[model samples]
Target: MVGVLERLERLRAAADLVAGRIPDALAGKVDDVLARSNRRLAVGPQTVVALAGATGSGKSSLFNALTGTRLAEQGPRRPTTATTLAASFTATNADLLDFLGVPRRHEVAPPEPDMTDLVLLDLPDHDSTATAHREEVDRLVRVVDQFVWVLDPQKYADAALHQRYLRPLAEHREVITVVLNQADRLTAVELSQCLAHIRRLLDDDGLTGVPLLATSAVTGEGVADLRRHLSRLAAGKRAASARLAADVTVLAAELDRHVGPARGSGADRRVVDDLTRRLAGAAGVPVVVDAVRDSVRHRGTLATGWPVVSWLAKLRPDPLQRLGLGRRPELESPGLRHSSLPARSAAAHSQLSSALRAVTAELGEDLPGPWRDAVAAGVREAEPTLGDRLDRAIVETELPAERSPAWWTLVRVIQWLLIAVVVVGLGWLTLNAVLGYFGLGVLPMFPLGPEDGLRVPVPTLLVAGGVVAGLLVSGLSRLVISAAAGAAARRARKRLEYAVAEVAEERVLAPARAEVARHDAARAALDRLR
Candidate 1:
């Protein structure tokens, strides 16, 4: 189990982590409590107990009786003691008094030396009609190590005392003592009835186990008992720590109401995958993939088609260039060049928006209103930059068509050899026709089938065989290139999608997830205090 000091430290860490995220009022309270607690701990081990009550409650007289010295003055006025009067039982309490901001201080010698480290304060009336007096009491109440509430018979059950002061201090019962002052005024029967009523009222305020007694500052009816109680608290030397612990417990409870459940792992992987696909679509991945396929086929045709018709292929547009993609010198520097891919269609924007909303919904699920709003706000802030990020991802991705495969080179060589044979046969036929027209000796023929029965001319055979073989090779190359184009398109799609996924994670998921992590951190610290 964690100690009170450890819990207090955790509470401080939590408060700092959630400073700007929670409500201003709650955040301010956390700051004020921590500041007071730290300053109180720094002063000394001396227990600083305060006499807190409404006007005409005889707090000043009780203070004088407890110290055996007239440290605080008593008068017939409605409100007395606008400032605090301190009585330190020890010789070296000037530092503590200075820290408490009390200028009027006195040293006292008590019967018990064990109470030497005690420092008692006579505070202003908490319910005083004077605003300054009430403000002084309220300020000291927050930092005092313990409280002694002095009540009178007539107003023992005053609503302002119970509701405003006692009820809120219910968690600090261990550091609080209640006394019904002026007990000498009431008869025995009436005193018994008042004590019973006070008991019931304390129970209702959730301060059931707190010490209660009746004392008259003048006759000293229960003053001896109150002194002993205060002595025990001082001797133990744990009152300050106990008081701080109670303060932390109350703050933790209030903060826990605003903390939601923890989601430590961040965005779900499945949701991320869905988001990647949507982002890829918005980035025009499909268009890029189709361009890759068409670019490959266009280049393949120029490389392997018949020389006669190959010049015609140059007349058509290059698919990759049309999209402002492929291996361009300007595009070598990442993020500097934008593609000519068309503007994102309405459907693409809708999908992108829907995907982003899904991410926000998942992150904000089960969270408190403020934290959920924080997550959504983070996503919305990043939404405008997403389009630019996606475009950059697409431009930077390496497509397959950017580098030609080795097979295309080998096929191109074979096609040139076939074209060479066709050229030789066509020249031979033209030379033979010119010779025969000029009545020169005719070129010799070659035997084709059974030598004497069937013979064919050499030029005709050369011309016929080369034409048939060239056409056959061209047809086969078309099938292979088509398959290769499809495979290249598939590879390009994979790379583009990968790039888009990175954009989604960096631009969309990371920030939203960070907010969730922050909430979890604050919540976990508060949980330890519980």
Candidate 2:
């Protein structure tokens, strides 16, 4: 036989199976019965007996005589009992028998010492030829660990008893006891004949192994055999507990049908996959790509030969409007403003945040642990304000209004200076030559020979050209500074996008998986109870 814990598990499994199929009324009753049985079983090995029969069968009288007390009513003028009754006295606390809902029997008796668990319930007689009394007996009989199926000499062969209770319980032959109670009323020859006839009826009822004893409450004839049997049962040295165990095993097999097979996988992977897909979309990588592209173009133009026109870079609808990515730079001059990469990137991050919030909220009903708290916090943190930072950076840098490649700027300055130099050089040489040819060379470096006669020196003019070239070189240097700043801003936007995705993953998405694991563990524990 299985051990107690294993037995309990089987019982629970059995209960779980028919738990649904059983009608509500029957189910509650079974639960009550099983719950009480578990408490009683906690007392260890014991036998329980419910002495049930027709009115005036001397069942209660015989029970009192066997237990050596008036444990149940005996002076019965049979009106067919109107109420159910029970009494328990044993070394073991057999009070658990009361959980069966049979009323306490009216009795004058002393409590017995705890020697062994034995309960003898004196139930309202069934076969009372009364419907209500019959129902009561049946109810008590269903839950007893074993039954002492008391019968009188007159009813021992009654067709109703044979066909109804005794016949069905015949299969449980070892657990049943049938007595021809009040048998002292018959003579020896008649007693033997009555006993033989009862055995034949029992055989007809399919219960050949059942033990039969003849007893009288008045004469105490053959009572010791019944007590000895009850004692052995109470000691759990009875074959009946093992027999009932077999029945319990059958019940366990029935219950097993309800418990599903065990396995390790405990999650719906599809849910997480769906979340990942949605979050990636919300990150808006495409928008960031567009912004970076524009920045790259502006940088390339500045590097090649775009002139001060570079400052004319325009971003529409305001960079600040890109989700949480804030305003365009505060470059006061339309001439110096460039890249909207940062704003576009920020928009992508916004999408990712909303997606995370949505998925988390979707799972909120079941969300467990830090994941629930983290997702809510992350969305709040995502709201950004870049307004004043860009404004301050732009204002502090005295960027020029016009923009162009340093090369273009330098080329422009050089061409102008060269023209001036060539013009003056040619003019001076021409004038000096003309004048000299007219014999004015004696006046020397008065190169213009006084067209307006300020007598400017050719060397001095050459020095001015050199100064202009130096200024052009300075202009180109500033262009490089502006182009580099734009490139850096472009890179910053990309970095920010990546940063947002990382934060959302760590704070929001990752925690959700943990929540699934935690709650699944909880579910697993509950499943074990069944």
Candidate 3:
């Protein structure tokens, strides 16, 4: 029961969320659906004995007879009720009737304490195809705890009654009561035969376990027996209203399963998840993280005469094209008789409206003004703008790190190496000049100075030194950068896991949790009402 209520709560919350955001008619529909839900929750769960039959069934007579009141008008003529008729037992039950939208009239019953708890509804002639009539009967049956299917002797086995009402509401068999009315109009022998025939037809209708009773409102025969049964039902100590509410809610939820998970999902969240991951990768977090680490390890290398390398490391990558982040995602493919999220969302919203249409149809009242306004507010609150929301979500996203250029360090290292080579070459050139001035030159590769033999130019030696430094720096930078990049990739991947997890919680998990909480609240409210 708790689980069932929880599900209903979720339905109510979802309805509330979409109610105002949808179009006018849609909002109106959702507003009523929620109202009915609350009414179902709050309606102190009485048993409804719906008086059903064709036009001449004298069903109303039975209702008046059972309560011992002239609540329903009777005639020697046809169609006493031009519209669907109803009279409930409680007056301060304004909230419940307001919930049900059956008009209020204080039709006094002749003081039967046994009848106080029972709300016997006098239904319209089922044969009448009046839109209003059919709708009222449907509304009554849905909320009613016990259905006392009133039938006349002649149309007791009517095909329309069985096909239209009986078969579909088979779930309410325990609460279904088949009353064979106008028994006094038949001879005793004929009454017995007709009762037997009705029983046989009931069996064929698969309503065998349902209680079938005989009565004549005019003769008052068997009325006490029926009243006696009703009295015992009311006298039961169980929470009848609570149980019925739970039952209706459970059935409604079962029907909701056909809608599937795609019904209430948000498109913004889906788009944002994919976008964040791609954007994070493109921002070059792996590269940036690696460089920060390497810079820390070789902190001295940059601080002490390696400003060039450090400066080059400061160049950030292009955020968009770095990891295919610039490309747009493929739109959901088109299909025959199938649709994408936008299309399905439209359909689902439409379906949501259609599902709730029965609520107003039953009650025969326009939605209360506040409720309609609230529904509009809710729809506006839940309005989906995947692009706008996605952009905002992206703007808020924090990448773990920003990567500098891969070649920047090499450029810096080469600059330092060039400086070292120039100094070395200058020393060598001065040594060669001094040695040649006194004929003691020993230039390692070319042993003689300019004066002693064939000499190397000082500028040429400097150039050679510069080439050596450049080559060494290039080779070393390649090795260092490789190691740095790999380490950065690993760290970035780990950090990215946390980022994704956080975003998922914010966008997906958080919304889902809220949905669950709303459902639980609704379920609790409904249970309290019950």
User: Which clashing pairs does model 3 show?
Assistant: 9-519, 10-519, 20-375, 20-376, 20-379, 21-379, 21-380, 45-241, 288-403, 309-412
Local error of candidate 3 at residue 352 (angstroms): 34
Q: Which segments of candidate 1 are over 4 A away from where they belong?
A: 264-270, 445-447, 450-456
lDDT at residue 29 of model 1 (Cα atoms): 90
Q: What local lDDT score does residue 443 receive in model 1, on the 0 to 100 scale?
A: 63
Per-residue lDDT of model 2, residues 471-525, tens digit only: 5654564466556546645564455444444544554555554444434443343
Candidate 3 at 299: error in angstroms? 15
lDDT per residue as tens, model 1, 440-503: 9756655376666767666666767767766776678778889989999999999999889888
| Whole-structure CA lDDT of model 2 | 0.56
Candidate No. with top TM-score: 1
For model 3, the stretches where C-alpha displacement exceeds 4 angstroms are 1-34, 37-48, 69-71, 83-112, 129-139, 142-146, 185-193, 196-208, 236-254, 259-530
TM-score of each: 0.95, 0.43, 0.52
Candidate with better lDDT, 1 vs 2: 1
Clash pairs, candidate 1, are: none
> lDDT (CA) for every model shown?
0.85, 0.56, 0.55
Determine which window of 10 residues in candidate 2 has minimal summed lDDT: 393-402
> Could you tally the backbone clashes for each prediction?
0, 12, 10
Clashes of 3: 10
